[model samples]
Target: MCGIFGYVGDESAGPIVYRGLETLEYRGYDSAGVALRSGGSDELTIEKRAGEVAALSVPTVPDAISAIGHTRWSTHGAPTDENAHPHTGCDDRLAIVHNGIVENYEAAKADLDEHTFTSETDTEVVAHLLERELDSLEESGPDSPPRDGSPGRPDGGTASREGESADAPDSSDVAWRVRRALESVVDRLDGSYAIAAIHERDDCIVATRNESPLVVGHGSNAAFLASDVPALVEHTREVTYLDDGDVAVLTPDSVSIYRDGRRVEPSISTVEWDADAAQKGGYDHYMRKEIHEQPTALRQALGSRVDVDTGTASLDVDFPQGYLESVEEVQFLACGTSAYAGRYAATLFESLADVRATSVTASEYAFTGGRDPWRTLAVAVTQSGETADTLSALREARGAGARTLGVTNTLGSSVTREADDALFIRAGPEIGVAATKTFASQVSTLALLAIAVGRERGTLTAATAREHLEDLTALPGAIQQVLDREEQIRAVATTFADSDAFFFVGRSYGYPVALEGALKLKEISYDHAEGFPAGELKHGPLALVTDETPVLAVLTDGAGRRESLNNVAEVQARGAPTIGVTTAGVDAGSLDVAFEVPDAGVFSPLVANVYFQLFAYHVANEKGRSIDKPRNLAKSVTVE
Candidate 1:
């Protein structure tokens, strides 16, 4: 989940990468770095810092033509300036910034010598390996035909350390030398990686993704590459999503894509979401800003699923004619917040698509036995495609010959590339470790996908689906209604902040929303809150409900479902503070406090999360835990 940025343009890559990293800082990382092929040197020069990207200290960003950068969530080493990316190798002749783990880096590192390498990071292994391989290739192939018709020199330029002349191997030669080295290095690596590099003396930047993410952003005489669109949102709307095993080289005047050593067709997709979605505006915390942004986020996500002109609601997938028809079952896999959405998706699929979709944690799905794979569809969901378990599950399912699809927010994440089909959530960048908008967007996308299946099968009528589509457009306002209540919820949160423990309960669709709310509380507030289906209260949870306990229930304006309301009354009998989220117009009689939300056509985990997140966030703020960087947690799931 590291945020990566690269640019070959008139603009300073330092400023672009720095700000872009800030936009993506919500993903959580320990260190950051950027490498530029400065005009004064033929070798790649770099600067890096531990901690936040904004904390990186650099002397100056020279008016260089190209640069590559990474904000890392550390894996192989502790968070420190020395472990940061843009790691130099081959005596600083090549620098590389990487986003994923290197499984064989140690074995690869052992094979290289005479190439001085710095840093203990697995990413450095890539640089050293690239440097050595390229050097070997150059030596074998009559020496890289001097980059740009310039004289080549040993040791990549300068006299200070390597006995190289001041006139040195030209900067252009250094760049070509580096690129050739990188191309050879690319051929050897394994595992997921989005690699960006600045070749010594080379004027252009080259990047590649193999089961990782990289996007290309367009500019007038400028180009950009970032792990996610929000990093490039400020620069351009026209972007290209790189597929797995795709290589792209970007220069100010051109961007080229290659696949299997041949020029490949690259589709440029225009991004509708812009810099505004990535910025926090005036809010002190991204959670708060994103809680408020949910209104617009919901509208946009819903907009993509439905074509107003066609009056149809569908996931943006067109399967082969016989695939969906032969599908007999579906397994929905995800972890964390996306997992909660998957639970609800299973329910929606049962009712709307008339299919039994079993929702399971990705780890179990990938490794467990006794699951039927034939005639099944594996749907994996995540805000970031780099999620390991989810990706592993998708791989296993595909190995078993199941048709697979992915619903993800990032354009070119591993999940996006690995799935037989994939759809991007338009919720933009969700910075808070606790997902707010994307959670809602994922479930909404799932619902849309459900509707799409129904439409494709003729199980759903066009008019009813069309009305659901229109109601989705109004979700922005419904979300706004919830955002407007944060100040009031802040007051409510104070009542629960002192409680020793919290219990959340819900039934039917409310169960997943309850689970997500509990997760948000656990993720940031570090609270001991747990969600249980209302039916489970009598089974065991009732023993924990006492006067000191607080009960936050998803009681959205529903008529008594017999035993469920009776269970709620049982909680009140124990004198637990019962905070209920209900429809605004409903009379929530005798409830301690009723957090009212606008009535969405269906019970939405996203909208419900907004209200619950406000309560948890305000409680966390009152309890004084850092919301942005919770203890023992980092953004981006880089480590397994």
Candidate 2:
């Protein structure tokens, strides 16, 4: 995935665009570039480089009123200066910044034999194609004006014949010409993309999207466009999300949207979080700040949705009456940390609601084995809600006649519009490439979903449901208690930072936590790590254990604590040091290092996860790793 930002305003365009790119750097950091158009000029000034946003040197263009920038995650070519975005035509009259892939770029390039290709990128073809379309229009009809300051005839001549006066075409406006050229260019291209183009003669930015995300921000005497909300939150909270085939013309005064060459109105929504939420807030890194914010994030997730007295949850999801009673299976579709959240939810659904449930990686999802679509409910879990694989799986499930629900933290994300019902996690902005707070919020929200489903199915008694509700209400405090002992976890991480490898072992609900813990360590620390069900250690993984390797065991209550402790002893027998995350009064004499967590019944393992997150953060900090933007990892996976 790549990030795109465009601005047209009274203020200097270069600085505003550069700042927006900085906020979106987590989405893509391979390269950065900007294209600026000064007032009353048709010549664009371009600056680009093959590195992070901080590496790019933005020129001071005080009078530049329009600009478009991009931070790229390379797809077609290596991250080089030649491959960086803000691609221009041979004449350099127009500049374009693109985000997604052009699947049929090879075919499109073959047709544009008259244009000289510069870089090895699918995006460059779009610029050349638009250039060619504009040139053709100037040659074939009087409906377009030549770029040079000259009055032209329908023929390739600048002067008219004797006794003949040439009249300017009605559609000779710069915006009209650019829009027509772009429409022609897009018709010849294939695949997902969010493209913003600026011409030297036009003081506006023409942007369009197909299967990729683009948001238009409305501000005082300004207009902004970005791939995500973080880039626009500072400028304006009000935004309009662009849908497929929607083209928007953004000027300093107004934004006009069109689809299929006809005007259309799009609803504008305000982002709930502000720019400060995206900052590290005084922490060493974004990952650390998000880790400590877990308590508040969990409280927001549980806000007013759960009723402890009634032993029920009102998630504001509108499913048909009697729909929960008719459900025979619950299938969760997700990827990465969200997949781990889904795995945790699957266990709770089966245990609490007495239903058959399974978690499937979204990329490998299939609705097979003769399952009845009407009786099957598919839930898609994602933090950004724009994850391509999960959206693909959701579409497949909906096409097969299954009612789908989306659980995500973003309000206007694609998942909210595509699914039949949507549940917001309300975790706020998470800027770290390695997920921390969103994972906790996803699990807490899904736990509430399980409670509601159990009550609807009549499988859980009122007192039992109330007990689970009480544990949830106490979850925020439990996580806070773990956050208070951050120094102890940091100390443990310092000792194990030099270890050859790491292993995390747990069972039941703890299994997903162990998997998520290992993911966080490997993602940020760049360490060798693996996670397994505690019982599987003896089957094959035990041979890899040694004193040089440190094993972390999740021994919290209600997550097979006794069984995991036995596995910890097995690791100790193999001469491997064991670190146990347990509750109070647990026998942890066999563990080399033990961190006590607050007791909250089944949610204790979630509290234990905070220790794992802090340990990973400290280990990466010790190794001098880039914890916020880990190498080769982008924040959101927008491409399949």
Candidate 3:
């Protein structure tokens, strides 16, 4: 998950790019860069570094009105100046930045043997290709040759056939040359991307996306493209989600779109969320604020997934019916918190639909691989939809001849573009790095897909699916009921504030919650927390129960999972002070603490998982870590 922002309007590019990336810090990145084409100079001036954008001491932006910036979550190479984008072609002739993985980079790299490279990035290949195109376009443009005085280079020009570079273009010729170069360059790309380019000769900004997200703000000349919405919402609520293979060129005075070499009008979408929704709202940290936002967050998601007017629950998804018919078995693949959602969905999938389901953690999917179990279906789950391991597994499943479906929150995200069919998790933009609302949304989408399958196979009555969808629609209220207990959780976190080691135990569906609980604390809190299947205690983990390690147990009463409380008692007998996540008002005072979740179905993942996330987040915040941009824990893993 990387943050990308561009401005082509009258606003100052520096502040816009900076503030935009600040909001996107939640996306997670290890490096940052900005390329701007000022009104005068043609070349794109770029300053990239190998560290958090928040930590950067970048130089002030030049006086140009149009600029583009990127916050990179490393994929092709290590975090370094040479590896960060915007990557340049030969002698900075062309510049580009990209957000998706190019599966055929090795082949592209071989073609670049004659060209010199300054960065070890997959994204740089676009620059090289663009440079080649620009070189060919130079001779035929309205402007005969690019003049001198570019931004990155005070002088700009191309290299001669004999290998000597030509003089740099002057300021007046920058815009025309840059635009022509880009038009030619853009035609050669073959993979997923959301691209924004600064042509040195043109007064405009050239931007586009193919199976990637690019949104144009409602303002007459303003435009934005991000993997998600919140980054651009600061400028305008009226927006458009660019279609697959669509190209959009933006300028302060104009915006045009194209599809498969033909011009087309893009559909506009209005977003109601305010910039303040992306802010922490007086909370100590964004993670804390988002964790508390789960209840309303869940409700908002439910509202989007189902149409209130029709009372007919639909995925609100657009895909060919033929795609669904091709799917058979489903392998639910994801990493970390998302994987738990996948596990719950696997159960939901099998019960609601006539399909067999297998849940696999992305990290281990390859190792467990082999065999034609059936004409398989791959359902990849991710909050950001950019997880590296999951992407590889999706490709692996596809290679195995399975139909692929993507369940993700980010529209135009990589997984959505790759899948044969996709169901969007209407979670909006999840700002907290540890994930609260996103996790719930993943479950929501997966469940809905299951319902959709049930509808298809006739296993689930349409009325039953509709009623459950209605219940799902009401889940926001139940979620809100849980968020009201934030103060209570804050108080509880203080109790374990000084503890270093912890144990999380649960049974049944709660097992994943316990595992997720352990994961959240370990990721950001720097705590050594272990999650066990409760029943696995006697096998080995029980030895670690001690006064020093606070034991967290899942005990949701009235949820048919009473056996978990027995293990909660077992831990207490061993002198491990316990904290339990259970249904509201179930008193387990002997357990030292009990945080509550409303009794829900396997839909319980929608509530309980969030509560545990809150528990971990508060503990980390109490320890004073950057909860939103956790150390070494990225919001999205986009490289394998």
Clashing pairs in 1: 27-635, 28-635, 171-201, 174-200, 175-200, 175-201, 175-202, 440-606
lDDT of 2 by residue, 130-191 (tens): 88877776564553344433233423344533433322221225665677677668876788
Encode model 3's per-residue lDDT on 12-96: one tens digit a residue. 6777777777766665578888777655655667788888886655436566677777888776799898887788877774467
Q: Which candidate number has the best lDDT?
A: 2
lDDT of each: 0.75, 0.89, 0.69
Q: Taking the tens digit of each residue's C-alpha lDDT, what string does model 1 give over 441-542?
A: 888788788877867766677786776666566677877888877789899898789888888877777888888888889888888999888788889999
Q: RMSD, each candidate, Å?
A: 6.2, 5.1, 6.8
Candidate 2 TM-score versus the reference: 0.95
How many clashing pairs per prediction, in order? Answer: 8, 1, 19
> Which pairs of residues clash in candidate 2, taking residues 3 or more apart in a chain or in different chains?
42-200
Alpha carbon deviation, residue 85, candidate 1 (Å): 1.8
Q: Which ten residues in a row have the lowest lDDT in candidate 1?
A: 158-167
Q: What TM-score would candidate 3 get against the native? A: 0.79
